[model samples]
Target: MGAPARKQRSGSRMGARLTVWASDHGRAAVGALGRLARSRVASIMTAGVLGIALALPAAFLLLLDNLERHAGDWDDGAQVSLFLQADVSPEDQAALAASLAERTSIRRTEVVSPDEALEEFQAVAGMDDALAFLDENPLPPLVIVYPVTGTPADEIEALTAEMGEHEAVDTARLDLEWVQRLQAIMELSRRAAWLVVILLAAAVIMVVGNTIRLAIENRREEIVVTKLIGGTNAFIRRPFLYEGAWYGIIGGVLATVLVEGGRLLLSGPLERLASLYQTGPLLTGLGLQGTLALWAAGIALGLCGSWLAVGRHLADIEPR
Candidate 1:
């Protein structure tokens, strides 16, 4: 009988231990969740602010990326137009094209006769009647040259200068304005992106900090009681840290949703704009990497904010 009783008592002890363990974990989880849910208004407000802050920078980044992609595809075929001298014959222009085509840097060359140039100008300028009234075509023949891929800019410029110095070539024009402007714009966008990221990060920190401060104020009595009952500072701080983490996680998710929603909203209009310009699809919004970074940032902000709050306020709240 004694042995059976002892076995029953041991089983009861095990069951009680299991129950207590389960209850503590459950309560802790509930406490963390409840704390977040209780501050619904504050949580939603903070999350919305974070979403807007993240969205602005993210939209700017997407635009910058698309612009860079378009710039990168700029026609690598550097154009060099050689205007023929007034006295240069059609045969002479043809010979020049053949000669330039033999150079390794020259991918292709073509000679446009004076009559063809006049017709092209007339069509483009919508002045066919004006051109017909003239006794003879005033436009000179042109030798247009295109360089192969990997042709250095300096080499192209030198080639243009050499062509312009020729007896039959009156002038040579190379359009390098596109490349210079694209490069400048890309640099400016890069700098602006960095600035946006910095400002957004500071905004996140402030949001988390304020949230943690409010949490501390709400839980002042709980913290005081815990300290009085021999609960370690770490144990008391654990739930607040968890609260911060929850804020970060929720904020990150909210931001992602906002970003994706904005992308969907703009996609149709963007596609239409691309079609009008005869361009391929343009990418927008945060990609997988960006999404992951946002999540990590939110979690880090939460942890840091909680740490700062507990470290500063907890020390001053010790029970006398």
Candidate 2:
């Protein structure tokens, strides 16, 4: 009975201590928020800087994503033109196209006879009088081959080379230079965006740390007095950590707002541009997942910055 009673008492004490700890944390968090509210202008200015920093990379990445999506739509137009030898018969050209169509890499093949090619050139070039002087059509029979969707650029190039080697084909031309250039630009933009993100993240940490350090300096006397009264470092540190967290949360929210606002502003112009190409909307904003990640990143940076400031500055403040 005595042992059981002792265990119960111990449990109660532990629960009481936990409740006190949680209450203290809650109070600290609320108090820190109140302090920020009291200094609206300064807090807003600091958070505004952070928001701009966070939004730049986020916006760049979002733009890159949208461009990549638009580029994918362009991929459907990528096709290889296989110009057959002049000597190849119509039957042979059709048979070659049929064989290429059956391959896994080739989606489908379209055959254009020499006469059709000449007629198309004449229609577009308006050179009927000049062509009438020629006894024979100059254009060879053509086979246009479209690769499977989502095929790699290298694979398409390889397929082009393979098709060019065929006996009936004079040359295989893949008109994908624009697509390749677009992909290269996308890769470069992605890397540049990441670089900007890293640099801005470092800037955010430094800004938060400096801000927290100034705060600690302003409260030097209070901290010293608390220490003299037997307050532990952890207890003194709680409110400052909360202050940093609040800064981060506000900054993250501001960043989201800025990004969305920018997206809305650009959406109209982007839609107009996409309409010229008969494509769908080209602008995509930071969705739910991205917004949450931005918030999480801000919070983490804030906590880290504040922890560093508190650990360094708080230790220097001692009861004298």
Candidate 3:
């Protein structure tokens, strides 16, 4: 045959072989799915375990995300209290508050006169009678400054320091201890979430691997016969790999359902609570991208687990 004809024939053979390979893979995948459906209860039980394992971490991370968002709201609520000099006049105090309020960093400011400050203290401390004994009020006028929401903590601190330096001011204090504590808590929660993710991911792999190993043993005789009849190792391994992939896909779907279901269950209570506080939604679930990523993770873990099981156990099944 001429060179061109021979090349064409070779190409046709390659294409034909590829088509057959693809067809076999399609059949193996469908067969694996059908086998699982035949044993519905056991398949569901295995998938359920994997679903729960995956869901736990996803739920925790979602909670953490909500918390961080709420904490940011708290950051906006933080206030700075400025104590005026004892001798500073009420007019000067009001003027200082007004000046502070005009600054871009300051959201607004309230001037509290000595009498108002003392009255508030007496009400809170229940020391009205004790304070009556003093000839003159000892409390200083106050300027309560609310920083613009979402202002950086460092900028807030600098603003506080600037307020304290004002001629009419005695001291400026920003109660940020609570904010610091919240930051520490968020950091700890993030680390804990990561740890849970790692542990649960491993558990999922082990679960799938053990299940695949059991399947390999149950089909040992069939595998031996196939090998004796000239089946390649890849051919024997294909169905099990598809089986593992199906398990992963199912588990991933189940996990998504569990997480979303929990979110739905909590949504009403959370919405009511947020309404009471006059805030928006307090919790959010994994959106489209996140759901896809979770499904991909499930498929990857399933494939890894099945590959490990097949690689180890398939080698031991011989035609002896």
Evaluated with TM-score, which candidate comes out highest? 2
Per-residue lDDT, model 3, residue 320, is 79
Q: Ranking under lDDT, best-scoring first?
A: 2, 3, 1
Candidate 1 residue 164 C-alpha distance from true site, Å: 5.5
Per-residue C-alpha lDDT of model 1 across residues 1-320, encoded as one tens digit per residue: 69999999999999999999678656765798797788788778877777677667766777788777776556464689999898987778788899999998888998888888887888899987777789977888899998775565688889899888988988899976677676787889889897988888787777777777877888889889988889988778777777777777877888788878878988999899989978887766678998988888778877787788778888888787
lDDT, candidate 2, 1-320, per-residue tens: 69999999999999999999899999999999998899899889988988898889888888888888877777988899999999999899889999999999888999999999999999999998999999888899999999987788999999999889998889989988988887888898899999999999899988999989999999899999999999999999999999889888999999999999988988888889988978888887789999999988888888888999999999999987
C-alpha lDDT (0 to 100) for residue 128 of candidate 1: 79
TM-score of each: 0.73, 0.92, 0.85
* Candidate number that wins on TM-score, 1 or 2: 2
Badly placed stretches (over 4 Å) of model 2 are: 2-11, 123-126
For each candidate, what is the lDDT?
0.80, 0.91, 0.90
**Per-residue lDDT over 165-244 for candidate 3, one digit per residue giving the tens place of the 0 to 100 score:** 98888889997778878889899999999999999989998999999999999999999999999999999999999988
Residue pairs in clash, model 2: none
